[model samples]
Target chain A: MNQVIETLLQHRSIRRFTDQSLDREQVETIVKSAQAASTSSFIQAYSIIGVTDQEKKDKLAELAGNQAYVAANGHFFVFCADLHRHKIVGDLESADVEDSIESTEKFMVALIDAALAAQNSAIAAESMGLGICYIGGIRNDLEAVKEVLKTPEHVIPLFGMAVGYPDQETDLKPRLPLEHIYMENEYQQDQSLFKKQLQDYNKTTSEYYEERTGGKRADTWTGQMAKMLGRKSRLYMKEFVENQKLNKK
Target chain B: MNQVIETLLQHRSIRRFTDQSLDREQVETIVKSAQAASTSSFIQAYSIIGVTDQEKKDKLAELAGNQAYVAANGHFFVFCADLHRHKIVGDLESADVEDSIESTEKFMVALIDAALAAQNSAIAAESMGLGICYIGGIRNDLEAVKEVLKTPEHVIPLFGMAVGYPDQETDLKPRLPLEHIYMENEYQQDQSLFKKQLQDYNKTTSEYYEERTGGKRADTWTGQMAKMLGRKSRLYMKEFVENQKLNKK
Candidate 1:
């Protein structure tokens, strides 16, 4: 594999970082890399907010479940699924894009546009020898995020990212087996085969955790997912999104 | 900038491909790079379908509005927003994850997961001197996609990508201005400023099109957006997603 693929495979979410922060040029390269990602029909329906204010960064850290890395990283960026500009475009052009912007298809486009751009930024940062972690915890309090970021309606901060030089190295987190994630043509829905694969992965993940924690913890991926998803958290997201006038077709 | 960042910034959708197909090793590396992407809560709520069968590729090419490249790329990958495996996980652990899997948050997770992975695969392929194009036209008809791909519940084909050796190289499309797309600490909700930036970008895009097409198409981005989003398309997507037992909350 080439250096690019090697860099991608080396990815690990860095939860802790050194005091070194990103420079303006580095931030420019990262954001420029993000701009190069594909958009749906060139709709360009996403916006990224780089949190530079110390107060806002601290508040966002608190909002993101007290993740200090969020505030103290090299740089923090809030990637938003924004359709507000499309509304402005409609207004400027005197075109009725209200129903289209409100449509679920467009909502998905915004989310995807944001995600593609974010991954580009993440890769760009990593290529520059920086570490990065995605802070989904930002969604813990969207209302607070809106207040802190002054996000208007039709714009939602989906996630934040912390980028910096690594303070520590982490063992690679084992991913789901290739067969489990990739299929040929049709989805391999054979439940028997699927169950066996997950069972095997559970063992691999359990072993990984055990080895990493020195036998303090060994849990299955399924168990972790079940615990995380079974419990009600972020239940307000749906209502929040709809109330923000997005994804409510 | 390093090669990785350079590869990312040079991205342009390659619609025409040489007859050279991707080998198994290349496909494995691409998919492996994809799996290395970050997943929320370790849910890994996504999967990639590598369309290898000639028959299925032809059908998909037809389904994707007869995009010939979809049928004849080095490889075609359909990035799916999959929570079916989570359902399986729930069943194995007997965890009540039905509501969680159905929530819009989970839907967003699946979509973002798929996109991050897709972009990784795109970069991986491009780094290897291959070119790629995302085929969102796959959503032109989801029911047909389900039938053709045999996708199950809680599994949606979000987008398709065609990767192969390039038969052509297109110029980089102009993106939204940095000031418009990137803000500091807060969303810059300045309509006048936003309009001016877009209007400026519109000129850039218009000149780009003019240079590329010899004035055959000198359209503004806002005009194109107004034309595309002003009209209704894919209205069935809302009901289709709900009917697929996803994002029903």
Candidate 2:
């Protein structure tokens, strides 16, 4: 395998970082690489806000479910699904953008754009021998996050990312078998087959957690899913989307 | 810069593909790299359906706005934002997953997860000296796409990707200036600054289209935006989401 594929397959989410800061040029290259990702119709409906201020980082870390890595990383960036730039482009040209910007399809496009770019950034950071983690906890307090980042309407803070030298090593987490996630021509509703696979995966995951947490958190993947998806959390996302006026009729 | 960064920076969408098919090992390696991508809370809310059947590919190409590449590529994979597997997991455990699976946050998570994995897959394919392109036109007819793939409810067909050897070469598309896409700390409403930069970019883009299309299509970025975003298109996405019973209250 080539270096790129090796780097990709060896990926691990690093939550702790070393004290050394990233060089400005390294951060710039990361952003440049992110900008190179593909976009729908080349609209480029996303933006990255790098957070270097200690105070802001601390507040952000607190708002993002108290993730210390957000504050401790050599660099942090909040990727925003933005249509504000499109609005500006439309305004400058006196073109009608209201219909498109408010449509659900446009919203999905922006989300996909931000995500593709973020993945590119992650890969680029890893290629440079930097550890990185994506912070989805930013959605825990969307309103507070908006205020913290001073993000305006037509934009939503999709996710935050922390990049730096690794302070701790982590094992590559196991995933479901290829057959479970891949299908041939049509979707398969093999309930028995999948349930059997899940039971096995659950046992493997239980052992992983047992070893990782020193027997403190020993639960199967199903157990973890029950705890997380048992009840609705982050329900405020609907309100946030409504507040953005993106729910086109 | 390294080969990885150079490959990322040189990314170009390849629509025309040679008749060379991918080896079985190469396809498996690409999927393995995709599974290595980080998932939100480790939910792994995604699935890939590799469509190598010509009859199925032709149907999908027709559904995806008749994009010839969809049928002509050496391989095609429909990356689905899937929650069906989670729902099945919940069913097996008898967990209260109804609320969570139907929420907007969960929907966003699945979409982001699928996009991240798709990007990793794209990068891995490129590393193997293969070309790929994302097909957002999948959304143009989601119901037909769902039927084509036999995808179940709680699983949305987010996007499709075509991968293969390059039959035609294309230039690296230009993007806006760094200052326009990258902000520091807070959101910037620099309308005047961005407008000036966009005007310059539009000129470059106009020339690109003029030279590439043999003067058949010559327009600025703003001109393209006006034509695309000036009217409401793909509004059925909301209906599609609702049809999946994901419109949580």
Candidate 3:
């Protein structure tokens, strides 16, 4: 593998940062890379918010379940799935696009566009020896987040990325085996085989946690998924999405 | 900019490819890079399907509106948002994750996960001097795609990617100006300024199209967006997603 592949493979979320911060040059590189990601049907339906204000960052941190890194990173950027620009375009061009813009298809396009750009930015930062972490905790309260960010309708703050010099290093977390995740032409849906693969993955995950936490925690992947998924989470997402005038169709 | 960032910024979709096929080693490296992307809450809620059967590829190409690249690429990959494994885990572990697995939040997580991984794989392919294009055309008929691929419930085929050597070169498409897409601490919702920026972008886009198509086509970004959004396309997407047992909460 080349340096680019190596950079991608070595990625890990950095929660703690040093005093050093990212300069405007680094930010430019990252965002430029983001813009270059392919958009569906050439619809550039996304935006980035650079949060330099300490007050706003602190509010965001509290709103993201008190993730300190959200406020303390070298630079924090919020990636938003935006269709308000398209709405303006429709009005300016005298085109009737209300139905399309409100359709779930457009919503998916925005979400995918935002995600592709954010991933590119993350890789760009990693290549430059900077550490970055995506802050999904912002979704904890989208209403308050919208209020704090002063965003208008048709723009959802999907996630945030905190970039900086790392003060802590994390081991690479094990992923599902390639057999389980990668299919050959057809999806291998045999229940017995799938169960066995997950069972094997459970051992790997439990050992990973055990090693990471020095036996303080020995958790299996399924056990963790069960606990996290059994309980409700972010149930307000659909309602919030609709109220924001997005994905209403 | 570094080589990695340069690879990203210099990206353009390649519609045609040479006969050279991606060997297993290259596929391994690319998939490994993809597996390293950060997943939401470590759910790893995504999967990759490699289609090598010519019959399946031809069917996909036809299903994807006869995009020849879909059938003629060095390699084809389908990135799927998978919650089936999570459900299986729930069953195996006897965990009550039914509601959570079907939640919009989990659906978003799976989509984001797949997108992040696909972008990484794209970059990895580009770094190796291969041209890759994301085929959103697959969404035109998700049912047929699932039939050809034999995927089970709780798995949505989000997008297809065609990777191969470049048979043709294209110019970098101009994106929205940084001023328009990038904001300060809060969203710049000022419609007047936004409109002006978009108008400026319109000129850039028109000039680009004119230069590319020998002045036969001078399409403004807003014009294209207006025209595309004015039509009702993919009206079956929401229902298809629901029937696929994804995001049905």
Candidate 4:
């Protein structure tokens, strides 16, 4: 009902952006807003890299599935699920924390921490009248991202975000109904209810694609998900996380 | 600069709550605002379980490292990183999606999706003059949670949230300096810069604890991290992820 809630509820991902650049103060405030988000145990296990150089942005754009918005946006940031700082903190305290930091739970902590901060950044940017899109496509090639960003081990680039003045507005994408997404205190194994919800949702999605893509591609939600999930996507992410030496004792 | 950004920047985790309960309409509005957050590829791989029953809340409180707030908050929600709906969606389309749904990337997608939604929910709660605290302590024992919540396979209880009108106001926890957390174009392997920033921050944190605890406990950020990360915490999380049949081909 308030402006903040209104800003959040009217959210949309913007991929295309005008050529206007974000001032330093705006980016600083945005990152500050991100820092204010909740972090597990106050660990604050995340880092963000602002990519402004055109050459580097081009390389990053290519690495992230050629998302031109990575370079074209007013600002681009790669949010890193980082524990390397903890390592330094341990070293400063003369404690060996490599094994403890490498646990899968710790890794999940960092990953979730990065995501919470990013969502705050996204909302903050939007509140400032900026358009933004998340580029999970960065995972399309993690090795290149590591190299391009010189990201050290114990630090993984989870995703990138592009922010700028809007070049276009997009129709809000439909989501699964609230009943389907919100359960009671216990998980409801309602196969019939779930099936019924998706059938109607798929119909809405089919029309959404038909309208958006000019009938070139009109498929149900299940149809699209099946096509996507039928084959292996991002199969290398396990190896990527493993290579970070996170899943070790 | 704006009210929304100001609200975000001033956020603090509220663990103590007054004996106030959220109205049904408020809960409905909060969940609706959560549903408005961005999802990856429209999968919306997340679910919110509202827990208002005191018995279940007490059990969840015990399970989540005895965080009394889990039971005392105005409203509690267990945010699940769920792919179970996608499974139903698959069955509706009669598409084999097990392999695709179980990949590490998809798992991360779900995890990030849940966090984004939870953050939105937190902001929405705050905008309505509510208070919130995230309970990652839920991961302290996921099996108990799954049993309590009847969570099925492919659905992980990612985290919980306690929302209420604040019973107590706590100081905002300090974060690492922007220079330490933000890099330009590439990851900065500047150990010297990180050390400098952390030393100052550690001093600030030590004073904060000293002041907060009436001089009973005075520890630096590095000191806390060293003590916490010196041993394996949540050692069973790897097996938990493994048990979900994710992160495998």
In the range A49-128, model 4's lDDT, one tens digit per residue, is 99998998999888877878998999999999999888887778899898778887888888889999999999999999
The segments of candidate 2 whose C-alpha lies over 4 angstroms from its true place after superposition are A214-216, B214-217
Q: What is the DockQ of each candidate?
A: 0.88, 0.78, 0.83, 0.80
Give the CAPRI class of candidate 1.
high
lDDT of 2: 0.89
List iRMS for all predictions: 0.7, 1.2, 0.9, 1.3
Residues B18-43 of candidate 2 have per-residue lDDT tens digits of 99888889889989988999999999
Each model's lDDT comes to 0.92, 0.89, 0.91, 0.88
DockQ of 4: 0.80
Task: Give the higher-lDDT candidate: 1 or 4.
Answer: 1
Q: What's the distance in Å from true for residue B200, model 4?
A: 1.8
Q: Judging by TM-score, tell me the better candidate of 1 and 2.
A: 1
Q: Clash totals for all models, in order?
A: 0, 0, 0, 0
Candidate 1, residue B112: lDDT: 93
Candidate 3: deviation at residue B202, Å? Answer: 0.6
* lDDT per residue as tens, model 4, B1-249: 799998999899999999899999888888888888888877888999999779999999998888999999899999988898888767777888998788888988888999999999999999889999999988989989988899888898989999999999789887888888999989987879778888999888988889999999889888899988986689888788779876554
- C-alpha DockQ for predicted model 1: 0.88
Tell me the lDDT of model 1 at B136: 93
What is the DockQ score of candidate 2, to 2 decimals? 0.78
| lDDT of model 1, residue A120 | 98
For TM-score, candidate 3 versus 4, the one ahead is: 3
Every prediction: chain A TM-score: 0.99, 0.96, 0.98, 0.96
